[model samples]
Target: MGNIDKRNRLDEAPFRYAVTKTNTVFIDYEGKQIKVLKGKEAEKFLKRVNAADSEKELQLIMAKITGNFKRGNER
Candidate 1:
């Protein structure tokens, strides 16, 4: 209850941006955070990854709702 009541705390939701602090650059991925990126490369990389994940999830959900069935591709 105490942790939840911390009004000044900020949490990262899905696709939320997380700014890190360091003297150099970094490249962060799932299960990985390396200091090889330059400038805002890390942030761009994270945004791209998040967008890709969201796109994939949306595609899956859309397929399910639209009836994911396989048949001859007759157009």
Candidate 2:
């Protein structure tokens, strides 16, 4: 016998989903859906994603999240 647990890990994700299969959208603090990326809007956000501060922040945050994964047995 084996103890196998099934859980939706996306519920445990720390980040928000910005881009889906096609459209790019995000929710604001007011809970309003904001579609500010994709098409012409992507140009505006490109600089931020490529900036030094943004790159450093991304590395730091992703490192913490990727390092926090746990196996099903450990859960």
Candidate 3:
């Protein structure tokens, strides 16, 4: 088997399931994995990822993407 085939069955299977079928989504940013909704939500999340300056920035971005923050915690 080739590298990809061998890697896919490795001890550490680095993957995550975002959505299914037409709404499916997957994100691997700087070696980290993220899953967000599709359509407009995905667009907004991508913008945040593009704007991230640090790992903290990315996490905050993800929190915003997932709507996990209260109004007081969002920027």
Candidate 4:
């Protein structure tokens, strides 16, 4: 996870999430919608996001949820 933190700068804070009235979660990166969660998944994600201590931690959680984001070795 340290490597991930190194690759993803906390200063930039590239992840963002929006929750709808219908309990749907929309996860985005750099202004692009990347993942959506609903039902139990959205509930769980909301819980985790609420429990996150800082923006950096929240960013990491979003990155993990999105999965397989750029790892800096693409050719």
Q: What is the lDDT of residue 60 in candidate 3?
A: 48
lDDT of 2: 0.38
| TM-score of candidate 2 on Cα atoms, chains taken together | 0.29
lDDT of 3 at 14: 29
Error of 2 at 58 (Å): 9.7
Stretches of candidate 3 off by over 4 Å are: 1-35, 69-75
The predictions' CA RMSDs to the true structure, in order, are: 15.8, 12.5, 13.5, 2.3
lDDT of 1 at 17: 25
Top model number, TM-score: 4
Worst ten in a row by lDDT for model 1: 8-17
Residue-pair clashes per candidate, as listed? Answer: 0, 0, 0, 0
Model 1 TM-score (2 dp) = 0.24
Off by over 4 Å in 2: 1-17, 52-75
Best by lDDT: 4
Rank order (by lDDT, best first): 4, 3, 2, 1
Better of 2 and 3 by lDDT: 3
Candidate 1 CA-lDDT value = 0.35
Better by lDDT, candidate 4 or 1: 4
Decide which is better by TM-score, 2 or 3: 3
